[model samples]
Target: MDVDVLIVGAGPTGLALGIDLARRGVDALVVERGETLAPGSRGKGLQPRTLEVYEDLGVLDEILAAGGAYPVGMIWTDGEQVGRHAMFDPAEDGEEGSRFTGPWMVPQWRNQEILLARLRELGGTVAFGREVVRIGQNAEGVTAHFASGAPVRARYAVAADGGRSAVRRALGIPMAGETLDPDRALVADVRIPELERTWWHVFPPSGPDSGFLALCPLAGTDQFQLVARLSAGAEPDLSPEGVRKLVAERTHLAPEAVTELLWASDFRPRAALADRLREGRVFLAGDAAHVHSPAGGQGLNTSVQDAYNLGWKLGAVLGGRAPEALLDTYEEERRPVAEHVLGLSTAILRAEARRGAATRQLGLNYRHSSLSEETRRDPGPLSAGDRVPDLTVDGVRLFDRLKGPDWTLLTLDSGVFLVRPDGYVGWAGDTEDGLGTYRARVGLG
Candidate 1:
């Protein structure tokens, strides 16, 4: 095998996996179909949970510096501002329990830049224009054949490819979930007359037939992304002229004022999840595993997180330091989380389109597993419906003590908590007897 693991895709998911694996001193190869790193802002808004993951990867500071701080979170409206929940605000929730208080809005392009730079610094380069054409697995390892006729072997293969995943297709894996919705949303990044002090504005029922308009300011650029639900067969051009007309009709702006259309693209909402996140020695991550609506900007963040969860496990398994069962936890841990994100985003979009009741701000808490048996059970496994709590127990901040390579064990009141390498809690108990039992379960005994 030319490498320990083969990663297919060079976007945030693949690059993030590369950074994690390389930093851990693992031999991995990342391949991408694009000739060069894509240059455009597709997704923005980094969730607070993702920031904690980035912190674990040692790149949170850089991401924070490059991104814009958004103190105010998403606003829900049923024709009027019905709910305005704070997402990431330490002041609102207090210091200890506010794990992800405020989310930073960084363009996806910029985040990719940082990931690529970090990967290079760690002595790894993503091989561009390398598309995997065929993949074969044996008892010992796997071999991948690229379109360029290069054969690369590895102990494991991960499909971080996009929605149209070639590797997943080749493996005959089925993508199971809801079909793509019929609604067509027109998106464009353009410089319009200043929105003044407002950060985001949503005009509900902006058009006849329950259509709405969402205007959000883009950080680091003198542009605002306009998303409007178009009428069926409305045929709105994304060009400057079309955006001008849409803005004028939906808001107070005049058509003549909107100019400088930077980029425009149209997308249909689709929610899907791979039937299985792994197949034999091959695994899937990012859009290759699941895709959600762009309503809350969770698409990229979730996929990047999938890689973050899977990278360390793959490295450990391939390095012969952990049992093969550790890899199964990747799907066990993330599939349910993605399921929650998909449903939450779907609800957000439906509410926006139909002016329904506002759902709670998105939150993810892992409460399903043998490990949770020792601790108080959460309502259920982490869902997009629940917020992850931050540190502040027994006069210590969890993040403050959570630096370094090993998984952190944290307890609030003289107890033991086993944190998995991917940052998930494997066990938590207040008594040594309970801790010992859970520790043995996690292979920590």
Candidate 2:
């Protein structure tokens, strides 16, 4: 076998999963089609839940140091401020096991850099410019054929490739769901007038039907990224006047005030999920498994979460410590979550289409799981299944408890609960009630 695991694509999802696999001492290799790591800012905001995952990977401090912090949430249509509802801060509520207290605003490229550096520090490097042409699998292992006519074998394979995944297609997996609508949205990084004071502005100067604008403050006031949702019918022209007119209609800015235009491209919102996240020994993650509207900034976050869910399971199974059935749970757990999240984003878009005034956000609540059953109440406002409320536990906070890439096993009073690496409780009966059996089931024995 070429390695224990082969990861295709070196974007956020691929790199994050590579970091986890390397930390677990798993022999892994990541392949990317791009020769150089992407530098542009496709995704800018890191949700609280994703920040918590980065904290667990032992890189949150580095991430914060590299990126700026934004504590405030959405500025409502009525101009009311809605905070991020502190999920990982100890000073505010003193919740144990909480690490990331709020959401963060960091360019997606920076986050990928951190993950890539961590992977290299752990003695693993992503092989860029080397795309996989095809893949074949059998009972022994899986083999990936490269564009250079070289075949690499591994015990298992994971397709972290982007939305248009060649690996997924080679495996003949059907991606079932919606595609981009007729509307076309343009994203461009530019120098706007009076920047760096605010992180994001949803209400556009052009009005709601004209689509909202997202202003991302970069390193200085002179530099910023302005992502606006333009009409699908907007002519595709990068001329100064063309760009100026769009910005003017949205922000009422003067032509010269727009200053410089860096990069401009058009894309549409799409919602899709693979018929199945796994087929035999090859598994799919990130955009390969699902795609959705970028309204809630959950696209990249969801992909990273997908990688987080699959990484440790792949490690455990390859290391002979876990049954293959454990790998099946990845789809069982994340597919439903993706479906729910995509549906919510679609609803938000529909609402936005009608110029409705609703604070758009994606809330993840696992009320369907067994561990969440303990609460026994609908996840109204807040509940146990809702990202496991960050609370203080005997001075060791929940976020702090996620200091490494290992099972957490958090209990109300240390009652022998079993947690998976992805932060899901596998078994949570009682401390005195067959701990060994539960441990065996969780591969912790």
Candidate 3:
């Protein structure tokens, strides 16, 4: 095999997975079609749950240093400031269990750059301009053919390319989804010298059937991300002059005030999920497994967590520490969560619900999975499959104890809990009676 695992993308999902596998001494290769890392401030919001994942991956310090909080939304009408709007609902009182209570604003490009650097620090390899043309799997392993380079063979393969995944098409996996908006939307990163950076400037639609525009200052850069909804059938011009004219028409800023257009793209909001996450030795993750509207900021966060969930399982199996059947749980655990989050993203786009604790994704659990074992006759507030909170156990932070890639045996006054590498409780019992069985099943024995 060319490598133990072949990751077919170098975005956040693939790079994050490569980092996890690299740290575990797994020989994994991440291949990207693009010559360089993707650019633009796409999918900038990192949810609280994803922040914890970054902490575990050892990049939390860099992530926190590279980003800032979301600015307050300033409503504008007739080129005049009208009101101030809170972009996110404040965190509830008890939701402060984790260090992060709200989403952090880091441009997606910077996020991937950080992950890529960490992967390299762990001695991981990413091959660029190696696009996959086809993928074939057998009982022994999987082989992937690329557009230019020699085909790669590995024990397993993952498709993390993007929403329109070439690997998914080669595998013939049908993606089921619906369009959430008929009007097209344009997103761009621009430099507007005249605009103040303190607020996410918003311009509501002037009349019925018109569209809205918003300019948000990117957290770690001087560029502002411009989002403008277009009327149905309106052609989107991504040229710098076109973007400047649009901004000038929508807001008080003059066309010349738009100093530069760094990057721009257009898309229609939609939600989608692949029919299945795994087919034999090949697995799907990130936008390959599911797609979401960018409204609620769930797409990128969910994609990164997908990598976090799959990384350790891949490592365990490749190292001969866990049974191959452990791989099956990835789809079983992530698909449902993806489905639910897709609905949430669509609802948030349609204004059917408010962004609250659910969007934080801290409450996501895997209690229904076969891996979760609750031996205690009476379980407490914390149960199997739930995330183990970060508490100070005897002056030592629980997260500090659970830092490495190994499963932790956390003993509290109430009971004994086995924490998975992903920070979820796998087994909980009053004593170690059933712990042995659980350990043996997961290869901890």
Candidate topping TM-score: 3
Clashing pairs for predicted structure model 3, backbone only: none
C-alpha TM-score for every candidate? 0.83, 0.83, 0.98
What tens digits encode model 3's per-residue C-alpha lDDT throughout 266-363?
Answer: 99998999999999999999999999999879999999999999999999999999999999999999999999999998888889978878899999
Tell me the deviation in Å of residue 11 in model 1: 1.9
Worst 10 residues of 2 by lDDT: 353-362
> All models: lDDT?
0.72, 0.70, 0.92
lDDT of 2 by residue, 269-366 (tens): 78888899888889899899988776656678888888887888888887878777778777877888888767766765665332111111124545
Candidate 3 error regions (>4 Å): 92-96
Give the per-residue lDDT of model 1 (tens digit) for 211-277.
6776677776666777888776677687788888877776666787676787787777899999999
Task: State the local distance difference test value for candidate 1.
Answer: 0.72
Q: What is the lDDT of residue 83 in candidate 2?
A: 40
Candidate that beats the other on TM-score, 2 or 3, i.e. the better one: 3
Predicted structure with the largest lDDT when compared to the true one? 3
